[model samples]
Target: MSKASETAPSNLADIDSSAWSELETAAVSQQSGFRYVNLCSVDAEAKPQARMVVLRGADRSSRVLEFHTDTRSPKWLELSANPHVTVLGFCAQTRLQFRLQGMVELHGSGSDLAKAAWVRLPTWSRMTYSGGPPGDERAFEAINESVPSRLADEAEGEAHFGLLIFRVRMLDWFQLRRQDNRRALFTYDETGALAACRWLNP
Candidate 1:
């Protein structure tokens, strides 16, 4: 978790391994406290949409990343039309930037993944799904009245909860240092296996 430059290895082999190691570490350990990434997609008119989403889980071998969203959100509609998406993330402390491209599938209400994720959410987070549809016109300004307060409504909230599974097709990794910078790209084949890994000038 130490971000200090003093801790980086001097060997190129170690640096190479660390690039992927960091990603795997981020996937499993939230305690390191760095899990947010920006997800970008295209809307109906082909306009770009971007927002921050938490990395709920990751499977490197499968090249998949997990995220949750409100089923009523516009992003869902966009994804339905076009599943392709990209995730951009940076670790300032480590001076690493990750740009990942992929396709996303949304699991809602009845699916096994969605059902499992919804079951684990805390009551407060569950309440968020109780609000009116996203972008809906609101007449009143009472924020507290927007969401259900009682735990009994948690089941009702599940109707709007959603789980997004992003299958990564490519990943570009970059490392920044005062002395030298390094970058690499990893592309996945149709089978989801790593097809190529190439160094890029940085």
Candidate 2:
């Protein structure tokens, strides 16, 4: 193992409080190549489902995470029913993975947060919003499967687009290696202050 890996903290709390800030920075850094996260949601039976999604925003001060999705998607329903969810992300170059578990809040189509998020999306990404209701059943052999194209100017007026904000309560960081793996855990107290971190065996 590398020298840095050898000294890496096993417990989550052992990681410095600034580590959370660094992790958040890594998550949002466009140059870091970690723009996406796998969101895990569970159904009533506790069956788990996961899907890849783009990361929209994060407030390190508030410990809030945000991502966008069609309100019509099944994941939305699942999340609405069960607020608890997990977000997982991995950076291949760094050999690090972050698992964040938190409660979710679904915003409506025209909420302030939704508007702000929508404004941040580029035109190409907004094409996804043009799809008529996500996961809708359609006839086989349908043509024109592409999402409807829209001019950049028209994207802001689309009402169907929405945003989702997740309030992170806990976070786990895992760094992989050939030898001893390292893992760290961090959680927020009731007052949203950073609690102590600890190490765990990977």
Candidate 3:
């Protein structure tokens, strides 16, 4: 076998980092951001909706993932009615899929997190909030629905800028390999503490 093959991890027992830790690391990686996540939420009608979102932040200790969004988006309405949600991600490079279940707390307008996130946004990104609210019907030939490429005043975007914080309560992990597949489930207690980690046959 090649030297690299000889040193490769054969299974979870030899993993350099635990599942949660690896996920946290991936969430913050620029290379993984766009291809990283599919966030799921339940709407008022009790249907599940999934969408891709950039992974902006992650905290393993808190089991929390953070992302930015427009406050007026449909997701805000969906989350308002139900704070429960799931974040699904697959990293092809790692051959791993992660399904993270959690409750979300949204920060909008005056919330500290929202304010901080707003300050961090550049003017071009901030301009997205100044446009027509998300999901609004467009007249014939209506355009500029996306974030403006040019810089706009931060104040104009403040009203629509939102910070979404998802606190994970469980993690379901599945790893696909050439010779074998692996799966595991991790549950957390009420206090945001990991309670159990169990492996499953795949």
Candidate 4:
């Protein structure tokens, strides 16, 4: 099956449409190449931190992407301290790479965003937040001895649930082919209005 943005884009509008269309699909389809995106943030020491995060939602009109994370995770703390972040994803099938620069708004456990997302999460997915804090060191035996337990209730892991809303400001899109590779940059204003679009030599 042909994928979105799989063909050589004819114009800036085409690239813009294809990018958002694929993002919408990626947010819901596990099979999509963009399903998992690399979110890069800065730590307290000013070092760059990057990790894979699942794409949960996409809004083309608002130019926002949604993700879920455990509030106790290092990424959450990093983002809390500095909202500026870079999101990177590539689809091998389409040979397209998207580098997005944006600011993230974090909604903690009791926020409306977190509550709504929590309601939509499946039992197994919700259980992920119930585990020990992320990035914590554990003994090899302790890890090996861990086993899945029956889910307790709907609210079992709600305490650690967090919602990440990333408002995209710029997108650097590139496509690779045997010849005439192409690249474009799209800038969006604070209101998500298209501020500028330009083609660049790739």
- Candidate 2 yields a Cα-based lDDT of 0.74
Residue 41 accuracy (lDDT) in model 1? 95
lDDT of each: 0.79, 0.74, 0.76, 0.90
Which residue pairs collide in model 4, if any?
none
> How do the residues 3-108 of candidate 4 rate in per-residue lDDT, one tens digit apiece?
6444567699888888998899999999999999999999999999999999999999999999999999999999999999999999988888999999999999
Which ranges in model 1 have alpha carbons more than 4 Å from their true place?
1-20, 27-33, 146-149
From the highest TM-score down, the ranking of the candidates is 4, 1, 3, 2
User: How large is the C-alpha RMSD of every model relative to the true structure?
Assistant: 2.9, 3.3, 3.6, 2.2
Q: State, as a TM-score between 0 and 1, how close model 4 is to the true structure.
A: 0.93
Candidate 3 residue runs with Cα over 4 Å from true position: 1-17, 33-35, 144-153
Candidate 1 residue-wise lDDT, 1-202, digit = tens:
3355557755544554565566677766775334888999999998999998878877666777888898889998899889999999898888778898989998988899999988877777788787579889876766645444576578778988899999888888777788667787778886677777777888
Q: Count the backbone clashes (under 3 Å) in each candidate.
A: 0, 13, 0, 0
Considering summed lDDT, which 10 consecutive residues are worst modelled in model 3?
1-10
> What C-alpha lDDT does candidate 4 achieve relative to the native structure?
0.90
As for TM-score, the candidate ahead, 3 or 4, is: 4
lDDT value, residue 161 of candidate 2: 73
lDDT of 3 at 127: 73
Q: Candidate 3 at 109: error in angstroms?
A: 1.7
The whole-model C-alpha lDDT of candidate 1 against the native structure comes to 0.79
TM-score of 1: 0.85
